[model samples]
Target: MKSYDTIIIGAGMSGLAAGIRLAMFDKKVLILEKHTIAGGLNSFYARKGRKLDVGLHAMTNFAKKGERGKPLTKLLKQLRIPYSELALNEQHRSKVVFPNKELSFTNDLNIFTDEIISKFPHEKDGFMALLEDVRNFNEVSLENPYESAKERVSKFIDDECLREMIFCPLLIYGSAWEDDMDFSQFVIMFKSIFMEGFARPEGGVRRVITLLMKKYKELGGEIKFRSGVSEILTEDTKAKGVKLETGEVLLADKVLSSIGYPETVASIKEDLEVKPRVGKLSFTETILCYDKKPAELGIKDTIVFYNENDAYHYRKPKTLFDEKSAVVCLPNNFEIDDYSDGMIRLTFMANFDLWENLSEEEYKNEKNKVLEASKDIVRKLYPSIDMEPNFVDIFTPKTIKKFTSHHGGTVYGSIDKSRDGKTPVNGLYLIGTDQGFLGIVGAMLSGISMANLHCLMPAGAES
Candidate 1:
């Protein structure tokens, strides 16, 4: 049997961050992961000769090296990574295209504001008022107890199209709730994506993951991949240790789980009746590799949020693909290098329950249908490009499940904020998106904060 001060479950971005933090305090920590590699949602896989990025399209909360107190800056500081060494490349512009109205966003908040004023002259005051609320938003409780994003946005903007355009990205990005997403989450996503904008590292998320792993190992943190926890051993309402699938028991003073909270509860030996909040929204991601670059092919824009109609109800579709909206990302547009080829990625929501009942052949058939439909949408969005993709890869919700064990294969963990990384059982804590964080930066922050509150706060003795 192995023992440590704290045992962290899952070696995703959050788990690795928390492990590094704990080990920084000289505490012995062991991170157990089911997969052979780390980076759960923000991971990548190889197909043929291409290195296709799995989940992350872009890193939000972008900040420059000298920028102080920003989330990315703080993350680098906490992890001891030099900001300059990060070498982030800022995005020029990204567009949200509705049927009737379109908005472009940039790294500078003022530019976005200026565009709002230029596009909607009459609603400029209302948009500015909404920005003020977003800037001043400080609800003490982490739980999202206020009205939904749609409800809150409408309070400021009378124009329905503007309101939908403003909140559409937020809903698709952070919201797992169908009808509406909480206002607190809205403010966070708004501040992160719009206020801070997005920037990609020199090599993308793979580099980020490599840096995290290196820092973790340097701090004497141990990570065991391909080792999944079968049960969370407990005694008297407190976590004792974990039993691996290989039947090895690794004891610890405390268990901090980066896995989904509900997944954690279900992992325990005790039959706790905790109702897990399966995320309402999941997605099917299709990657297409082309022999021609976007610049060469007459496509300049990097990311396009396309909504076929004026309605920006960013809810999960009842079918495989939401005909109303889809996000198309051109990877080659952002990179400044002389890379000869390009990659196009299409992402839209999916319903796992619908795919759950399909058989093997039927599953392939359904995914192919979604894939073909996504390509049609992409071609329509860029009618000028005559270049055909040389390679294509499609990942459905089932792929997400196989990798992350998210019950619904949800990209957004859950909408419930009250969980706040705590559980009914003592000596057990939850971190990561299921606790309300939505993106890579937020998830890392969640890990750091949870470590401070749970493990590194001291108060430990193990048997």
Candidate 2:
């Protein structure tokens, strides 16, 4: 019968963020994680001495050190992390290849704008106007199910190509529901990525996770690894604490579920349960270790969104891969001091049901098919790389399910955008991807924001 002011589930980005906030406020906080280590999605796995960064490619909402009012700066302030310690590397540029056209955006807005104007001279007005709309777009909290990304953008822009292009990067970064994303979700993604651009941590995502863990521990917050909540303890319509799989009960004034909404609700022992209407959208990524250098191949950019002339559905694919872009990323391309053998990650959206019903042999066959196709695509994208992978590992939806226990193996969690973490059950809150924030930075912000409102606010004051 251990008691604390708060019990946070999962030690992922959001969970760690919430724990750090609670500890900073001098609240007795404890975080329980099922895995032995933290950074659930944005974690790494060692294979043959090379640490593979599993989920994080790059952090969105990029801001330079000491740049006030920016998302990155804001996060650093809340967590009390020094900007010099982060040592972020700005990406030179990123590519977005469409069926008939392509675009490139750089860390410099002038260069990004010039590139767009140079290519599509006639569509210059439309593109510039759209940028203004994106900057002035404050409709992040609008709750209209009938409105979608396509609905809002189409009102101002007339070009079908440019319209789809506007959604290309955002959908690839934060898509949860359908090809046409929820309008509010789109605004947040646009602000985080396009408006803010991207930056890479010096030691990658693990560095950020390590910093949060350190801050939480320094603040006297406790974290229990290999501990999982089997059931949520509730009585008289209010959550009391959690019952661990070890038959131990830890009481708390409130609980923050960073795992997910539906998954948390179903774990409650009471008759209260809510099922998630998932989009069946998931992903398959292949990590390849080659024997060549990126600079040797004349590869100027670190990442390429290679669309083989297909409109990005950004949702559940009909087949393994349809007319969509292959997200090809060179994780080691950032400005790290050391250089090693090449590591390339190729990912694409897929349907969970497409492989969920496979037999053992069927699953093997399907996995091989995707691997081979992906290898061919990698070679085609970089013809002069002299590619020879010493290690090739592919992770499908089954892997996602095994790691996160999410329905449909969905990495984006649920599709609901209006959920504000407050559930029908009192004293329970939801955060992370399910709470409508996407990517590593978004998840951390979601956790910190929700905790400040629901957990730290005054008894009679507005949250």
Candidate 3:
């Protein structure tokens, strides 16, 4: 049995990033992925010769080449990836659409600030104050304790409508907690979304995965696709190695799991004294490929956070899905429209249990209904575009659970995050969603930070 320096569980963004970091320093690292592909939630699939991105609507925290102190810049710098490789296309604009109000924003913070001032003039001062608070707060601090984002924002913004509108995009995009998010997460989202804003890699999520995989492979990192880990071997309250489902045991001095915290804990044979609460949020997305692009139909927004009601309910739906609110993404609306066909993706919060309990036929019927509802939303958002989609595909929480192995089909993992990536078991760490970071950029950052802090620093010091 060959002993390795580190074994990373899951080939998701965090895992891939951790593997790359470890491998960069010549550490013998192996990444085990249950799926055939990488990217985890932010992955892609091909249907009828067309590639479709899964979780990536837009990559937040867009930065210009060599932009210092930015998340994107930091991530690329840490991973030794050049900014040019991303081929980022900035979003034309995105909106928060409420019942009687609409706020549009672009990559520029001025645009969002102006929109807020114009729409909610009274709350302008409060919004600015909130922005300052968000800017000043070190959201990435590992020692920071959890606080309700809603409560913290309430201190700045008094108008409930404005508050709901501001949080609509942020909450649905990244929050693991229902209704509200942790304050640190809120700040992270706020900076990434409103401050740095949105952009997409030229080839969607595939571009990102390809870049990561290329870098990781160049560093001599080893990864095994469809190599699902059955259990994490522990001895004397420390990680010894991992046992593959096929009964092969690989020994490692350290194990870093990009899988969610609870899932990692469950995989361990030892009954560790910890119960990381699984998050309640999940989603169902409908992808429609139309004959004409959104721009051709006079819809130029890159993404629209659509809410029919004044209050945004960001929680698990009692029904199959909550139709009142949705995230409508127009991939073609970016600066460079690389898609051959116009694509519109609509995401609605859904209940995993409701979808999970359905029989095969019932599941199919429910998915059809969801597809119809998504079309209805498109119609309502843009009445001028009245044409049947050339192709339509819908994915539910069940699909997320099947592909990602995330509990509750959750896009974001457990609400209880391990900020420092430390687990109860020695030599084991958590990265990705449950590591308290948000979005793709955050996930990669989590992996890099954890790998540096827990793995590399000690090795370098010892050497």
> Per-prediction TM-score, please?
0.95, 0.95, 0.98
Q: Candidate 3's residue-wise lDDT over 228-281, tens digit each?
A: 999999998899999998899999999999889889999998888999998889
State the displacement of the C-alpha of residue 150, model 2, in Å, after optimal TM-score superposition. Answer: 1.1
- Candidate 1 lDDT (Cα, 0 to 1): 0.81
Of 1 and 3, the candidate ahead on TM-score is: 3
TM-score of 3: 0.98
In Å, residue 167's CA in model 1 sits off its true spot by: 1.2
lDDT of each: 0.81, 0.79, 0.92
Instruction: Give the clash count for each candidate.
Output: 0, 0, 0
Residue by residue across 1-463, what tens digits does model 1's lDDT show? 7789899999888898889899999989999999999999889777786666787677888887768868888888887888766667777678899887779988889888988899899999899899899878773245446677777788899988787787777777777787577888888788888899877777777888988899999989999999999999998778999999999999998898877866787888776767676677888888877777777767777778888887876666878667568888877766453234677788888878888779999999987887788778878887766667788888888888899988788887765543457777788888887767668888888888788877766465211
Clashing pairs in 2: none
Specify the highest-TM-score model's number.
3
Weakest lDDT window of 10 consecutive positions for candidate 3: 454-463
For all the candidates, what are their Cα RMSDs to the real structure? Answer: 2.5, 2.0, 1.5
